[model samples]
Target chain A: MKFDIGVILASGHEILSGLALTVLIWIAGSALGLGLGFIVATLRRYGGPLVNLGLAIPVEILRGTPFLVQIFLLYFGGPFIGLSLDPIPAGLLGLTVYGAAYYSEIFRAGYQSVPEGHVEAADCLGFGRIQTIRHVLLPEMALIVLPPAVNMTVILLKETALLSLITVPELTLTVQAIGSQKYAFLESLFVLALVYWALVEIAGQLGRLAEGYFSRYRTART
Target chain B: MSWKLFSLLLQASGMTILVSAFAIVAGLIIAIALSALRLSGNRLALGFVAVFVSFFRGVPLLVQLLLLFNLLPALGISLSSLSTALIGLTLCTAAYQTENLRGGFAAVPPGLIESADMLGFTPVQSFLRIKVPIALRLTFPTLISEAILILKASSLVSVVGVIELTKMASNLAASTFMPVELYAAAGLIYLAINQVVTLIGRFAEGRLPGTGVPAR
Candidate 1:
């Protein structure tokens, strides 16, 4: 069997479109996940024991199972409860919720890493709970949280490939389609692997930049 | 759901456990070998391990599975779906386990190595006896976590046509129109399996000497 770059290049238009969808889904999913994860983290922190227990069940279940199973349930099992979603929406929602579970845990760890004295100091200054959270806790946690959160983002990006399994026509599926159509399975898969590697590399570089930016205050203090 | 449906999912979970257990053990052995190669100070071996880690860790496991599924036949290396999935899972997990082991090896105290040298211990003996034990102890918790991760990831094998728990649920759901029940049951089974794994990890951690104590 011959390796042919030409075959992959010939399908560049389809590949580009698929890549666009992958990026779009990754951005939307990351945004939704981060926002929702913050909310869950906050609730877990301040919510009473009952609420914490209630939240832990779903979060643990999500973390414990495979993302593929969760998406299948949402996309296929949803109709039983009168909820139906298109492939893209289902993929986005599944990815978002799955990410939130992990992200929330990251946030919780971040919050815990902050010193207890810091919270007490805020209280001594007559800071309200919300103000302490917003002013004192968040800034400190931001530095600790960014790396893991960005890591989760990269994981979510890789997860976009799984979305192809649900027929969202993402890069993996598009390349596979081209592979079958062009009889260039190896070449097409090679293209797919390279594309995903590039995406991951880009995400990693952006993470480093964000980390450096977040730590600028400490750098300046020194 | 019906008892029969639940039992069917249970039966499928056996394959999930079988594949995941094999992958975790195989991955750890390969990871140890890779870690040894990295420590061997051979540039060629170092570069080979570096590329292997970066590629496997960078690419998604799903894509890797698909690539192997297709690429094998092209190379005239025909394999069963189970074997292909096993190979993919092992390779992917080995990359991660190798990284974790690298950290574990780094954390081994230099004083211990120096003391072993003073005691006339051969480099190989000291590494096998002193370094390997300390590193494995330091990395035990992480290794257990990696095992759970591989177990969850085992679900992806369904794509290669291995009838694991997830696939069984999908098939039964389609035929019985009980997607909700089947999927819920599948999710519960995964949760139960992972919980058992976590418990075993915790139990083993308690028994392992010097686990939580810092190396002197």
Candidate 2:
């Protein structure tokens, strides 16, 4: 009944494999989410009204619902809509789409944060639109976006835990399987918590390093 | 499936709101104390709080709920699913709100505190009369946003077998083979609740004395 660290040590390989899958899903989903968000933010900023409205409704709906519910809709409800996807793909799609909604907002904020004067300056330098975005906007936007984007990626990492319910062989699911088999619920869950804590700590340290690196540009400018 | 199902989802949504409201209020009260401790300049207390925040913030709420649900029974605690859900949510949100409140406290100008000292005000009196109000004003909008997030996150409670709105929708969908309609309705309900929260947050922001979200 008391937590048994020995049980966790015995099943270390199983837990580590689960952690690997979790990291894989997280990295893949987040990359897709960021790319999708970049496009959506750009479109929302520069596209016509219909395009804006078309993207806005889905983003709003995704943002408003819980990620668990979104997973259910995609995993359980997908078959009903003729989507017939496997758990891994379904989970990745759900995480990516859900993350995109939040990422789009962060990207939009970063896009808007670029000063108007900078764009005008780029224009005076005879920079084309694409050239201006590459030369003038992206560098500044990276500084503005890095902090929140890192936070969102951490959130996305935690969210991958929800995929366990959809039968993804992720950390939580793996732990639950071990617990049920060995009746080592305490040990398994405790190990699960530690794994996540370590991950988030590593992510936090990396985020701080990135923030410090990006802010150096501001200090140099001033 | 029927009007009865629609009404059932509505009734379950009441449970969702109840759980979220309880968790948010409980989280806020505990976070205030935690933030105070964080600002107290006691090394041991600060270290304790740092570990507490890191554990709660780092781990997923789903795992926390599972751990509490399983571990409590083993220890003879025997909490209900709803209680387990509430405890998980309260602890998790407390960590986040504590950080936000700490930021608010740090933003309080030291000059103002110095002047309060010059005016013969005690630390407690200055904190109560000046610091608390200003910090609350600065943090009110974020508090509302956190509340909204907690409301949506409360859907996770369904996993522990509480028949909250999301669970109700899944139940109806399974029983009646109406996944699309039911899930869409559930999504709409969530959207409506969040929209209302956002509107109320904006309205409250207009009345508060501090600056709000930055403009473009």
Number of the predicted model whose lDDT against the real structure is largest: 1
Residue-by-residue lDDT tens digits, candidate 1, A53-167: 9999999999999999999999899979897989999999999999999999999998998889989999999999999999888888888899999989998999999998889
Recovered share of real interface contacts in candidate 2: 0.73
Cα-based lDDT for every prediction: 0.92, 0.88
Docking quality tier of candidate 2? medium
Superposed by TM-score, candidate 1 places the C-alpha of residue A103 at a distance from the truth, in angstroms, of 0.7
**Runs in model 1 with CA error above 4 Å?**
A217-222, B118-121, B211-216
Per-residue accuracy of model 2 over A19-43 as CA lDDT, tens digit each: 9999999999999999999889989
Question: Would you estimate the TM-scores of all the predictions?
Answer: 0.96, 0.95
lDDT of 2 at B83: 85
- Separately for all candidates shown, the number of backbone clashes (residues 3 or more apart, or on different chains) is 0, 0
Cα distance off (Å), candidate 1, residue A167: 0.8
- Tens-place lDDT per residue, model 1, B161-180, is 99999999999999999999
DockQ of 2: 0.77
